[model samples]
Target: MSSLQDIPVHVAAEWGNALPVLHEIRHALERLAETGEARVIDLNAMPFGPGDEDRLLGLLGQGEIEARLDALGVTQIRETAVPGVWLVDHRNADGERLVLHVEIAEVPAILRTQAEDLRDAVAALDARLATGASPFPHRPDN
Candidate 1:
């Protein structure tokens, strides 16, 4: 086996066309902060070549929270190191990436519970309680 130093490593000098996309991401973040309007940047729409995705991911980095939803397909939501910025990845049943989005917002809309859903949940709990089917059945005081 050859020494580790003998191996050749190739490093690209610059980010190429990805700089414009990064700038767009920054502007979207500002817009979200000021107007509370979320923006999504679709990577597929951009002219991204090899290694560009990895570079962008490095810049955003991983954040505190990550979630996955499996309904019609698989949806993954991950926050970046920068607050209010998220990466939403959606894949079909065949495991192909259907959408790769960089969303700038206080929270990604996909991860938020809708008002109607909350109301329905409250109504359900109230009905269960009225039916004497308490969710907490093993109460020490009772």
Candidate 2:
């Protein structure tokens, strides 16, 4: 398996734009499952209460997320855990831990609104910059 590195972490407030990236990653995981490279774990509907991982496992056996993955043509062992950098307990070729970043969650609405505002602000800033003008707001403190 491979590890994640050099991934840019930008402060994006655009949930709409971010959705495409999530969709693309999900599609890639589906493809990986098809090629037996990796499994597609459906964490989107994973329960968040106490003992969630165990709950998900139990429910999966009851054919919840498993049915969804199967319908999507994914065939591999699947489970959901906390979303973050999961460091594999097993060592790799270089005696290093294999880490995977699990980013699973719906984008917040506040972020989308902020991102649109930021986009408009940046466009205005650029126009001011092109006109050789300072775009900073004049405040009494300044």
lDDT (0 to 1) per candidate: 0.84, 0.37
lDDT of 2 by residue, 47-110 (tens): 3343444333443233112111131232232223322111112224554533222322232121
Candidate 1 lDDT over residue span 1-142, tens digit each: 3787588757566647577888998998888878888898898897777678888888889999999989668999999998888999999987789989999988888888988899899898687677766547564233
Q: For model 1, name the residue pairs that clash.
A: none
In model 1, what is the error at residue 25, expressed in angstroms? 1.1
Error of 1 at 11 (Å): 8.5
Worst 10 residues of 1 by lDDT: 133-142
lDDT, candidate 2, residue 7? Answer: 59
lDDT of model 2 at residue 26?
62
